[model samples]
Target: MDYLIKTGCRKIVHFAAAQHLLIGKNRQNGYLHALYKNGIPVDDNLIFKCDNYNEAAHLTEKLIRSGNTPDAIFAVNDMTALGALSTIKSIGLKVPEDISIIGFTNGLISTMSDPPLSTIEQHGYEMGQIAVRLLLNRLSKDDDGYTPEIRVLKTDLVLRGTTKTLKEDKLGRGLLY
Candidate 1:
């Protein structure tokens, strides 16, 4: 989210899941931090909380119809992002040009999206492989004292046409509503 803000994104609409999971909470927190850091006052009313993709798409469509289109939408996951994309297009607006959409979890759906969604790559498979390796090491270790290992995977921000280039916005400050 900070990255988005720094890259000239304004008015972030997050599509959170109904269940309050750690991932969802963290993503929301990141949005808040970015808004705060950018000196943009947070607007609680702007946050659209939804249960699933279907609900998110419906709510997003409503917002668009109400003339409350956000500059960028940060979905909790790829599925939700896809839902928003569908709604945005259905409303006769072009992606990135009208509203930039970003999502977490660089799943296949993200890449399959029309413009190819920009997302945060979680690298779940690599993480799982590392976890299995660690477990096997622990299990096969001899009497020699063993120490647990910790591994942190890196996340990359994938660039795609779903977002606009910085030069696209003449005014450095992004659109806010």
Candidate 2:
């Protein structure tokens, strides 16, 4: 989202996941934080509780038809972003030209699209490896009670055919508590 703003995207539509979900909540927090830090006011209407493929298209279409066509669409995942991409193309609007898009979870299908989606790649394998190490280290400590561990996983923002050139691959991180 910060990248979108830096790339000249003013009106960004956020297709969010469920409020109760930690990942969704954290991502939304980051979105709001970026807007606040950048001095951009939040538009409640532009934020939708959507995360799936069909919902992405439906919300995107509804938004476009309402004349509140966004400058960019920040989808919760790659599939949802793809849905918005498909709808935007079908509606005769150009990606990034009309509305840029970015999504999380750099899945395989993300690269299969015509304009390979610009997505945040959560290094899941590294996360798993770190998690196992953390567990083992904790077990060796012989703690009497359970304690929580916090780890921040890094993400790679791969710029492909999505946003006009937000920059080369940039590094970011996600909080896992």
Candidate 3:
């Protein structure tokens, strides 16, 4: 979440499934922290909690109609992001031009969306390789107590057409700013 915000994402609309998982909660907290660190006031109304893809699509349509469009949407996963993309397009809004959408897990659906989605690549294979190496090291160690080391795998951002390089136009920009 911090990384996404650091990349210049402003308002973030999170999409989640029916049963929220611990990971989802953690991500939401991270988003909140990013907003706080950047001095952006968090608006609870901006957070739309949906049950599934269908619900998310409905909520997204409502949001766009109500004029509560966000600069970017961070879906809990790629499936939801794809749904949001469909809804946005169904309403005749140009993706990336009107709003930017991002998803996690870099799932297949992300790439298949109308405008391929941008996602966080969770290198599971790399983590598995590192785990195997660690296990081998542990097994080969002599009969002596050893401190267990932890490795945090870094994530990569896979850019795509779902997001715009520039921030969306701010409301009242011409008159206010």
Which structure among the candidates has the greatest TM-score? 2
Residues forming the 10-long window of minimal summed lDDT in candidate 1: 168-177
Clashes of each: 0, 0, 0
From the highest TM-score down, the ranking of the candidates is 2, 1, 3
Give the poorly placed runs of model 3, Cα more than 4 Å off. 1-9, 17-20, 126-152, 166-177
1-177: candidate 3 lDDT, tens digit per residue: 554564556777877543357666766776677789888889888776763678778888989899988777888777777778889999998877777888778977777887999888878789889999988888888758556887867878788888765333565222211
TM-score of each: 0.78, 0.86, 0.72
Q: Residue-wise lDDT of candidate 2 within 6-87, one digit each (tens)?
A: 8878788888989899888988988888889989999998898989999999888888998989999888899999999999
- Encode model 1's per-residue lDDT on 37-135: one tens digit a residue: 889889886776764689779989888889888888888888888888999998899988878888888988788879999888989899889999998
- lDDT-based ranking, best first? 2, 1, 3
Clashes of 1: 0
TM-score of candidate 3 to 2 decimals: 0.72
